[model samples]
Target: MSKTVFITGTSSGIGRETALYFSENRWNVIATMRHPESRKTGLEGRKNIDVIHLDVLDPDSIQQAVTHALTTYGSIDAVVNNAGYAAFGPFEASTPEAVRRQFHTNVEGLMDVTRALIPVFRRQGHGTIVNVTSMAGRMTFPLYSLYNSTKWAVEGFSEAVAFELRPFNIKVKIIEPGIINTSFYDRSKDVLSTKEITAYDTLVEKIIRYEEGNIKKGKFSPPSVVARTIYKAATDGSWKLRYHTGKYSGTILGLRRVLPERTFIGMMRYLTLR
Candidate 1:
């Protein structure tokens, strides 16, 4: 009786790796993406994997994917909400529409998918929900204010829901990873600053350039690292409410918790300038 897990955003990166890893470990995987017809390179002919169409933005699509997974596997033991995008720029430079898009995909979309799946889990009497938040949710960084805000909302939402769902034996967990070697930084949406704010153009450009360079240098951990952490959280019985999955995430988060506010801000500023 292998458990079934439904994962969103399987088009690439962490979602794809998690699907592959769980399938390899003898679990049924419902791998979903927004554009199922896209000519993607991963998840080709995996025996235990079923690729499905799921657009988190659309309630109908979410329902269809959940129904399909239940029919294919007979039951779903976990749902991983991994489908989201990143928007990088100064908060003042970001447009209202850009902020809405971030909340739509990261916050509202996640809630929609979870709400769609809750009834199914309730019927089954036991299940898990794993949210893929970032270290940015806990700490602020330059040019990522809105993106961080969305993740922070996710962190809060997941925490509050965990308490409510405990009576039903439904577990909620948050996976917080530091910068990973994903296309997130490269493919993030950009909201151009108004020309009126011309004074900060050079500073903003330098920050953006540095971020791009860091991503290209491949200093972040592989997607498999996150995939493994997610797999453990999904299957293991001793599930904690939160997991810090990358090398630096725990250390930095711990520092933020214990260090003085001014000291933490100073360290962050030094890192940003570096």
Candidate 2:
């Protein structure tokens, strides 16, 4: 029997590609998203894929999605937690509501889904959980403090869970991708400052201009690259805890490990500004 995988945020980007990649390879895919009736409707036509509704913020939706997957496939061999968004701006500019929303979707929502899956995996004696994090989790970037915080939380959560789940044969993996070509950048929410801090306006404007240029240039790796890496982590029995995808993800992470903090920060400042 072919193995089954449940992936969240399948409406676009990495999640969509991962679902398609696995389905093409003969794995049963439970592709889920917040709004299931949109352009992703055609995904249901795949030979072994089921597109379902899943709003990570809604516990009921999460439970329903899990139930449907379990009933259809009998077992969920892997789960790709890919439902998240980036909230970009200066930390001082971010409102409490914006910060809450970021954590709600990126951190709390992920844990909620993991909680719902733990018992099922335990019973089956094996499973894999892949959390889609980012290189920002390893190193900070200007104007992305809130987004980085959430990914930082994901990194810590995945690391801790890996140790806790090892005895149960439940493997946990973190896929840290560098700036991927995705709607994540284009569709990201920007929190505007309620009160202007004139001191940082120039810096903020420069960062915003840089972000817009990156989106227009579309220089990041294709989502398929991330999808392939996620597939390997889900299927390979190597037990690696983290997989870095995209051009600079691995190199940046490696530099953080070796370079002094001040030097690393200086290099990042120059790269982002220059």
TM-scores of all models?
0.94, 0.95
Q: Quote the lDDT for 267 in model 1.
A: 97
lDDT of each residue in 130-183, candidate 2, tens digit only: 999999888998988888999999999999988999999999999999878877
lDDT (0-100) at residue 155 of candidate 1? 98
- Report residue 104 deviation for candidate 1 (angstroms): 0.6
**Candidate 1: clashing pairs of residues:** none
Evaluate residue 238 in candidate 1 and report its C-alpha lDDT on the 0 to 100 scale. 65
Per-residue lDDT value at 121 in model 2: 96
Candidate 1 on 158-209: residue-level lDDT in tens? 9999998888899999999987877676654555565777766776887877
Colliding pairs, model 2: none
* Top candidate (lDDT): 2
Backbone collision count in every prediction? 0, 0
lDDT of each: 0.86, 0.89
In candidate 2, stretches whose alpha carbon ends up further than 4 angstroms from where it belongs are 190-199, 215-218
